[model samples]
Target: MDLLHTLTHRHTTKAYDTERKIPAPVVAQLLEALRYSPSSVNSQPWHFFVADNDAGKAQIAKATSSPFAFNASRVMDASHVIVLSARNTLPPEYLQTLSDQEEADGRYANADARAQAHKGRAGFVGLHEQAGDVPVWTQKQTYIAQGFLLLSAALLGVDATPMEGFDAAILSTELELAEKGLSPAVIVALGYHSDADFNARLPKSRLPEKSIFSHI
Candidate 1:
């Protein structure tokens, strides 16, 4: 597949064909891509809440009212909406759970290796904790996963509209994410584009390579 072509062709879908729905198999691939997204020291500190039905989508759409009302249709009319959330805090138990999963998956050679790996991951988490930016740090990781989801959608011929315009606090309350120690980070709507999507015909804008990159 021509990745560059896909990158250039994929636009943020502004309108979706509500009548159409993504196949279950394709949705599975997009979620799987998010599951394996990279993070610092493999700190997978995010959760995804998928809304495939009207009721579920309505719950997410609650956050899109008023000033964010413009995004309401994007959330409600899409075939699916994924609410990406980050862990509110990096508790020790959570870190140990990650280590245990790694061990169970045969990622560690032995107990010593497991301990060393755990310590290394904890050390990095400690830096963010000390800086009091643990929430910020985890949110950044969620964005990485979001990137994976977006690219995977494009590759699967799915149009995606990632939105940070919704009210996060309202979304958290509606989804009860805080009770689960999670904070809403971003939302992505997935579906096929509708005839009203002007972005599909517009040119992509970006700075020239020389201005945005430097090679030694």
Candidate 2:
């Protein structure tokens, strides 16, 4: 199927059938597709670690409040656990380039002028703050990548789920992601869906396109 139809056809498959293990090559292909996703200044501040082993899956599974209570069981049930992560610290060059471009836009003139007017003020809001917080930028990019991974997995004919209901600190410790300054953004369970999972899913919800999109 084409990208458009693939997107429409893909659903978050919660109950992966115990039918088949998702092949390693399939997961690799999904990552290859994700490589093409857009990123801030092309910094590509995200990393993905595909987990199929018991110990590795447990590390991610433990990064939750219940630490195996809810979704952890599903980890073992799926063909693979896909950890979508983002770096806490972005590349200095990415931030620098972004700041320069934003400053060039001249949105800060009034703010800068005020600070200049008052020597003691030191009152100027830097372009970074105006650009939105760093964490926000990183988080946004991660979600975008998450979308890519999900779509890529779907296109590969693999079922997947994007899950955010988990603990980052626990996951960081469990996955040794702290040294890398990375934290789990989401965990996607990939495999073929069980017949039960499909039967239990709620109908999809969406707003009309006219309401969500803008022509003006």
Candidate 3:
């Protein structure tokens, strides 16, 4: 599975081969992918809750919906479910250093990088307010890891469903993640596909790349 083909063929799989279960080690690799996902200034903010138990899976299934924004049974049918608990803060020391770097950049040098650094700094500062002064820049960082997870799974012949439609409160409880103040954003269901259980979804939809991009 070349990266390109894996990316192109990776569909939002709601129909999982219920009889098949994803191996534990493979799941570990997926998490590893996230663990190593790139972050701004290496502020990796992601916690993956992998649920393989029946009751747990049911809870996730009950909470989440599909990409098209529909409730899905296939969520519970997959071999495993993953929850992303992304904080909205960069590390304090990391923030401190970044702030220092900006101040130390001679006050007027390297306009592009400095501009990017400034905007990036602003983002970190904005998210800090979200986490009650805790830096939460890692939420966006986690998605980079997620991209790797999706691509890795696809290339490995595993199917996946990334879902954001769920009751965040309930999912937090089911995963016992609230104590850490971790918030749930999305759930990825993983396994092979079962044609019998397919959700009758239309093929993937998207806007044209030309419309989505522009060059100055």
By lDDT, who's the top model here? 1
Model 3 / residue 207 / CA error / Å: 3.0
Instruction: Write down the TM-score of every candidate.
Output: 0.98, 0.74, 0.71
**Pairs with backbone N, CA or C atoms under 3 Å apart (clashes), candidate 1:** none
Give candidate 1 regions above 4 Å deviation: none
Model 3: per-residue lDDT, tens digit, 5-118?
666667888677878998888888877877777766545566788788788787776565444336456677888888878864444565656556656857535667666766
Best by TM-score: 1
Please tell me which model should have the higher TM-score, number 1 or number 3: 1
In order, candidate lDDTs are 0.95, 0.70, 0.71
Look at candidate 2 and tell me the lDDT of residue 46.
Answer: 76
**What's the lDDT for candidate 1?**
0.95
Which of the two candidates, 2 or 3, achieves a greater TM-score against the reference? 2
Clashing pairs in 3: 88-135, 88-136, 88-137, 89-135, 89-136, 89-137, 90-135
Q: Score residue 109 of candidate 3 by CA lDDT.
A: 58
